[model samples]
Each structure stands twice: as C-alpha cells, then as structure tokens.
Target: MAGGRIVVGVDGSAPSLKALKWAAGQAALTGDSLETVISWEYPASWATLMPGVPPEFDPERLAKQILKQAVDQALTPEVAATVTRTVVGGNAAQALIDQAKGASLLVVGDRGYSGFKAAVLGSVSSHVAQHAPCPVVVVRGETGDDEDA
Candidate 1:
C-alpha cells in the first residue's frame, strides 16, 4: 500500500480514538498517508429538542476540534503532522465511505452495540464495513489513551 491512503473516522469516543491510533500505526507500517475524518449533523428533532442554538455555536468547528484533538492525542507529533483532517456535514458512515474512495483501507471504531439495539439502530462501523470503497477495520475496544474520550 505504498503511496496509498488510509482513511479513519474519529468521533471523540474512546473506541474512535483507538481506531485513529490503530489507523495511524497501520498507515506508518504500510507507507500510506493518513486521512482522519469526522462528521456532524443537527438532530432531526433539533427544533423540538433544543429550540435555540447559540449564534456562535458551530458544529463544523467542533467536529474539526474533535478530529484534530483525537489525532493529536493518538499519534506522535511527527505522525499527527502528516495526517489530513476532514470534517463533513452528514452521516459519519457515509462521510468515511466517501472519503475512503480510492483508498487502500478504511478504519473505524465499534461502540459495541449488540443484539436488538444493533439490529434496530445500525452502527456507523457496521454500515461502512458493508459499504466502504475499500477494506474496513473496526477497532472494537478503547485504547485507554484518553480517559475523557
């Protein structure tokens, strides 16, 4: 996979941070450039759930911050500097899948949804694993790197 790209999704979750670290390591081993992606979407019921959003509140900026912080926390300064960060305004799975086009690998994390919940509410990792343009690796557990993740 020399000269190729490895796309990974970061959502500020413990498992997602783990996936970022794993993806960075894999990218280093395979000589692939790393691209870290995050996505944001206003809830469908935003008007009812939360009537007002502060004018200064920016979801995209927050998403970028999360992605950058995750990469910074998970990878060394040298490796983090080499990463390409992307923040999309849509579903996380679709964003990763779209970013992974022509990539050698797509990496994501599993939140361990199972049984009824998993069946009822499909997970991003599972959806991307089934639909991504390249091979998908779902990191299944936390890295313990960020207690706050």
Candidate 2:
C-alpha cells in the first residue's frame, strides 16, 4: 500500500520462484519495494474442533513459517535484503486481491503446484488477473524443450 510498492504472490513452486526473481529485478529497476505475500488456510478439522487438544493454535505463526521457508528458497541474499514478507490466511486469490488495493503492481506465477490442467493457467493466477486492483503480471514457468515445441 505504500508508495512504489509491488506485491507478489509466492508459493515455493518453480513458477513462483521465477516470478519472485522477475519481481526482484523489476523492483530494482523501478526503485519499488517488493512485498511478498504468502497466503494459507488451515484444514476444516483444525478450524472447527481440536477434540482433546487445546484450540489455541496460532495459524498466523504457521503461515509465517511457511512464508519464510518459501522466501528463503526463492530469494538470493541480494534480493532478500530489499523485500518485505507478509503472511496471511484465506484463499490465495482473495488474500492477494485484498493486498493489491494500493499496490503499484501485482505479480504472480502463471502456474503453481495446484495440479490444475496443463491447458489452463493456475486458478490463483487467473483469479488475481481478473480481480486485482493494480496491474497484474503472470510470469510463466520455464518448460522443457519437448513441451515448448
């Protein structure tokens, strides 16, 4: 939401890694702050009832751990120094859309590990492109020569 800030959605997949790299480069070129958002949702069972266990589980902390791991895997030291991380809960698309409200641009991977059809873009990418408040860029993943041809 701050000035010259770009929001990127990351999920630790190859495509998302590529997106993060591209976003880092773009941020450097444009002097913008890159904000990486990792959204997660707990299982229904965890949310509804814990049975015998305490129900004080911190979903936000778990989400932060996931986000940190993903970011660590994707970013180099140079890139990591300039980026801010945000961990949130809920659907990836909706979380990203909400974050995009005051962003200069929204960046995402064209495909993730969601196991959707090869013929279609990942659902989160498609949803963000359709509904995000700022301009969206979907960075396509690298494909093998066989697939490219």
Give each model's whole-structure lDDT.
0.83, 0.81
User: Candidate 2 clashing pairs?
Assistant: none
- Cα lDDT tens digits, model 2, 1-149, are 33588999987777887888788888888888999998887656763454555567776776687667777777787778668998878888899999988889999998875434465558899999999999999998766753531
Query: Candidate 1 at 127: error in angstroms?
Result: 0.3
On lDDT, the candidate that comes out on top is 1
TM-score of each: 0.86, 0.78
Which pairs in model 1 have colliding backbones? none
Error of 2 at 108 (Å): 0.5
Which 10 consecutive positions of candidate 2 have the poorest summed lDDT? 46-55
List runs of model 2 lying over 4 Å from the truth: 1-3, 44-59, 115-121, 146-149
